[model samples]
Each structure stands twice: as C-alpha cells, then as structure tokens.
Target: MPKALLTIESLVKNYGGGAVLNGIDLTVYEGEVLVILGPSGCGKSTLLRCINALEPIQAGTISLNGEPIRRDSKDLPRLRQKVGMVFQSYELFPHLSVLDNITLSPRKAQRRPRQEAEAEALALLDRVGLKDRAGDYPRQLSGGQKQRVAIVRALIMHPEVLLFDEVTAALDPEMVREVLDVILDLARQGRTMLIVTHEMQFARAVADRVVLLDEGRIVEEAPPEEFFDHPKTERAQRFLNTLTFETVKKKAKNQ
Candidate 1:
C-alpha cells in the first residue's frame, strides 16, 4: 500500500455551536488528485483550511507526511512551506509585481537568496505560461492571469502537496477554462492535490478519486465514472442528477 501524504482522523470543526465538519476522516495518497464535490456551506473549504492549519479544528487531528499540524508547533512555518494553497480570490499582493509576489515567500520562509528565489519564481511563472507577465502588477492582469500568478507563487515554494479551494469559482466563464487547464496540467504531472470544486467535468477528467461531502460528512467516495454514473447514496444521486453533463457541456460550448 502507498503511504498517505495527508491524514485526517475523526475531524470536527464548529462555529457558533454548529458543526461545520462533523467527525470527518480522509486520507490523500501521494501523487493523486482527490476532488471534493459538495454544495455550498458543506465544509469542503473549511476542511481544506484545517488541513493546512489555517483554521482551528475543534476536535481530532490532521497530519501531513506523518507530522501533526498542532497549533503550538514551532515547525508550523516549515510545515506550511511544504503545503501550497491557491485560493478562489487569487490573493496577490497588490503592491508587488508578479515576480515579486512569487519570490517573496521563498525568500522569507526558506531564506533563499534573492537571485536564487527569483530564478525559481521565473521558472514557475514560465511553467504556468506567465513568463511574459513577470514585471506586471496584479492590477494590470486579468482575473485568469492573476490566478495563474497565484499558482506560480504557490509553486515557487516547492510544496509537497497543493490545496485548491474552489479556484475557478471567482472566474468568469471564459476565464475558468484557463485556470482549469493549469490544474489539469499539474494533475498530469502527478502532483498531489486536494481540490474543492463544482466543476464536475474537470473532476471527472483529472481526479483519481471523487469524494462527495454533504453536511460535513462524506456521502460517497468512488472513482469519477462510478461516482457520477452510479452514486451510492440518495444525496449523491440527487447532486449528480442535478449536474447533467449535457447541460454543463452546452453551457461551456456557449461560453
């Protein structure tokens, strides 16, 4: 059996006396793309945040590469450097140029020399097809370009695992494809990824496994074809039926 890169055991998170993640358990293998699909407010994003210690879990444990991400751990910074996150909003530093945004974390967290960091950042920018936009500021780029820069920024950190939180959610219809293409490319390269997305087709195309979450619990976990074609639970079936591939295909075609 392959060693799991990330493990969550009996995880729980609550806000205002209500549970967002209720006794959840999951494991992500190395070099696998695991896509979490669910309705809004089902705690998928919160689950991703908890994995990286961005959100405080109310109960249970999250371990990355066998090391638990405890709140008080002095090595949390080092842990974070190995876990890259790309958000929906493409949180670029407005004051920094694209190249600077990509290099900043490596320089500060890894203590890399400026020239070495810039070289790595530029290589990452090239990988994301944004090599020409190195000197551009965030305000000057389109939403897709900005998101690509965000991906490049995260990649420059040399993370062992990447977390994508509804990365295409904030994109326009046309822009969504560009971002998804980048993700698909990474998936092909065998990057370990945990993605929360509503793009079922993209999930079907690239995910090694699809996990359906409802009310903070996993309703179903299966390969994409099986999960879409033969959902094991009523909730899963309902969700799948609601997302007809024909409808989504037509919408994409029109866009």
Candidate 2:
C-alpha cells in the first residue's frame, strides 16, 4: 500500500450547537491529488480548515505522517507549516507588497534568512508569470494574480501536503483557468494535495482520486473516471447529476 500522508478517523466538528463535520474518515496518500466533491454546506471547507488546525474538532483524530494533530499544543505551528492551505479569497496582506506577503510566513514562522527566502520567492513568482509584480500591493493585482500569489506563498513553505478550498469560486469566469493552471502545475510536480472544489472538469482532469461528501459524510470514493462516470452511491449520483457539465463547457468555451 502507498504511504499515507494524511489520515482522519471519525472526525467531528461542531459550531454554534450544530455539527459541521459529522464523522468523516479520510486517508490521503503521498504524492496523491485527492479532489473533494460536495454540495454547499456539506462540510468540505470545514474539513480542510480542521485538517490545517484553523478550526477545532470536537471528536476523532487526525494524523499527519503518523503524528496526531493537537489543537491545544505548541506543535500546531509546525503542523501548519507541513499542511499549507489556499482559500477562495487570496488572503494576501493589503498593505504588504506581493513579495512581502509571500515571504512573511517563511521569515516569521520558519525564520529563514531573508536572502534565501527572497531568492526562492522570486523563482516562484517567475514561474507563475508574476515576477514583475513582486513590488506590487495586493489591491494592485487582479483576482487571478492575487490567487496565484497565494499559491506561490503556500508552495514556498514546501508543505508536505497542500489544501485548496474552492479556490476558483471567487474568480471571474475568465480568470478561473489561470488559477486552475497554477494548481495543475503543482500536481505535475507530484505534490500531495487535497482540494475541495466545484470545478468538476478540472477535478476530473487532475485528480488521482475523487471523494463525494454529502450531509457531512463521505458517500463515495473512487478514481476520477469512476466517480464521474459511475458513482457508486445515490448521493454521489445526484451530486454529479447536478454538476451541469454543459454549463462548465460553456464557461470554458467563453474563455
């Protein structure tokens, strides 16, 4: 069997007297790109947040490379470095330049030398076609540009696993491909990732495995082709039926 990079067992998270993640068990293997498919409010984003320790879990356990995640412990900072997350919003600091925003975590959290970090940062920016924008502020860049910077910042951390939470949802239809291209590049490098997205076409193209989550539980899991073409569960079938492939194709054609 492949080595597992992330493991969750009966995970549960509650918020304001309601359960957001209701008994989720998932395993992500090394160098695997696992795409999460689900309807809105089905705990997809919550699952990513919980895995990154941004949110607290009320039950169950999460282990990364065999180490249990402890929200109350000092180890969380280290854990977060190994599991970077990209959100729908770019979340770059408004006042900081793009270069500064990308280097802050490495400088503050990892305490790497400024020269080494900048060298790496520039290379990352270059790869994403934003080297010239290193000195530009977040507001100065477009949504696609900002999201690409967020992705580079996460990559500069060299996380063992990366999590993307519906990253294309906020972008204009035209800009979606630019962000998705960045993700596709990462997958090409064999980076281990767990992505929560509604972009089924992209998911189908890049995912090694696809998981269908509904009502806070996993209803099905399969390879991308199997999940999309022959879902094993009724919930998954309904979810796929609602995806509107024609609309997805139309958006692509428009771009």
* Worst window of 10 by summed lDDT in candidate 1: 240-249
Positional deviation of 114 in candidate 2, in angstroms?
0.6
TM-score of 1: 0.95
lDDT of 2 by residue, 1-255 (tens): 889999999999999898888999999999999999899999999999999888989999999999998799789899989998999998998989999999999999999999999999999999999999999999999999999999999999999999999999999999999999999999999999999998989999989999988878888999999998888888887787677667678888999
RMSD of 2: 4.2
Worst lDDT 10-window in candidate 2: 240-249
**C-alpha TM-score for every candidate:** 0.95, 0.95
| Clashing residue pairs in candidate 2 (N, C-alpha, C atoms within 3 angstroms) | none
- In model 2, what lDDT does residue 220 have? 92
Whole-model lDDT per candidate: 0.92, 0.93
In terms of lDDT, model 1 sits at: 0.92
